[model samples]
Target: MEEAEAEEQQRFSHRQRLKAAVHYTVGCLCQEVALDKQVQFSKQTIAAISEVTFRQCENFAKDLEMFARHAKRSTVTTEDVKLLARRSNSLLKYITEKNEEIAQLNLERKAKKKRKPEDENRDFMELDADVVGSDS
Candidate 1:
């Protein structure tokens, strides 16, 4: 169908754009000076860097998918990501810190929501209704 073809084209275009962005970022970083000396990367070096980075990203994605599937999960969780980063101690540590930070933030937000003025008003209204009904 034309719709399927269009969707496939869009996906291909999106992938190409992502690859180009990766290439550009790698090129920019490669040009940065190191140890007071300017650095330069040949086209082949840039291409190789981009290729390896992209391949790793793809492998990570697949691993995440498999991890989720193995757990019968429809969506990936932080545990899955942490497992994926198990090969790198620093990365795993960083991910654990971030996960804890986010968890703390979520708990604070939930507590704030539960303490809203409207919640107090609703409870008072319910209590008042029960008292009035009993009197009647």
Candidate 2:
């Protein structure tokens, strides 16, 4: 149907946009590194690096998808992400630490869930004040 074709076209367009954004970000990072090293990079070199980074990101996504599917889950979970990071010990450790931090934060949030509405509003006000203070 025409709708299906249109949806496919939209998906392809979104992908191209994502690729462009990633390419631009990779180029900027490469430029920064090259400057720090007092070296110049050619267009080809930047393009190559961007391509590799983009490919790696795509592979990581596919891997997470497969990991979730293998676990018989419709959504990717933290365990799936941890499995993906298993190739690098440091990454796994970092993720584990981050997960612990998130868990602690969740516990804190749940403990605060029974607080009065006024307390929650005050918390938001405090957060806003902090943001404003930091902007000065």
Candidate 3:
């Protein structure tokens, strides 16, 4: 039971690290894209990057480097970070895909319910005709 608890803690820690990586990665990318001097950061500088804990900075740097290399980009931009964040993490990707799917399903449901006035009128006319014929 203790072993199981330890494993769970390790798993949770890993997830937290990944989430921190993504957040820090985005913050760095935002700094780059926005060209804001107010936001200064370096991979070695942990205190500057508030999104990630000091211990996680090393891992974040490694992950960010790998992602940058995979993209074959000389500089990491917000778009690249976003793509990396989405691609490297299954949970993030799943959530994003699920959200998009839900949105599409909702749009389809709304479209299906949207009847043209002409079609509605035709149905009403048919019903009226049936009622009159029955009365006769």
Candidate 4:
């Protein structure tokens, strides 16, 4: 009986940690937004949003973990996040567009780095040739 009670206590402690991990600032932000809109948000309303946001975050993390497991990967990639966002068409489109934009930016940066050294070497060679010809 004591072992069972100890197990229960451990479970409760774990749950407390999990709940603590989720911040309640989202609820405060919601209340602020309600004030801006001239809508009075009660404590209950803030609590509800906080609970819902925490559940949503928990669900998303679970889904991402499932995707990672399905892919036989220990780490979740951006693809896993995109797959999770696939439930909403607008969200999927936005993620896709943003991913493309990031890829383009990375490619541009690589190209710029590659060009800089080659251009500098070419300029140096031209300067060397001009100096040699002038000495003649």
Mark the 10 consecutive residues where model 2 has the least summed lDDT. Answer: 109-118
TM-score of each: 0.77, 0.78, 0.31, 0.72
- Per-residue lDDT tens digits for candidate 1, residues 1-136, read 9999999999999999999999998877777743237556789998999989988998999999999999999899999999999999999999999999999999999998978978899899999999999999
**Candidate that would win on lDDT:** 1
> Candidate 3 lDDT, tens digit per residue, 1-136?
9999999999999978876776677666757755755665555553354545544666656776777788897665544445546746885677567767878999997786775666799899999999999999
Model 2 regions lying over 4 Å from their true place: 117-136
Candidate models: Cα lDDT each = 0.92, 0.91, 0.69, 0.86
Tens digits of lDDT, candidate 4, 56-109 = 987999999999999999999889989999889999999999999999999999
| Maximum-TM-score candidate | 2
User: What would the per-residue lDDT of candidate 2 be over residues 44-70, giving only the tens digit for each residue?
Assistant: 888888888889999999999999998
TM-score, cand. 4 vs. native: 0.72
In model 4, pairs of residues that clash are: none
Error of 3 at 95 (Å): 2.7
Indicate the residue-level lDDT of 15 in model 2.
88
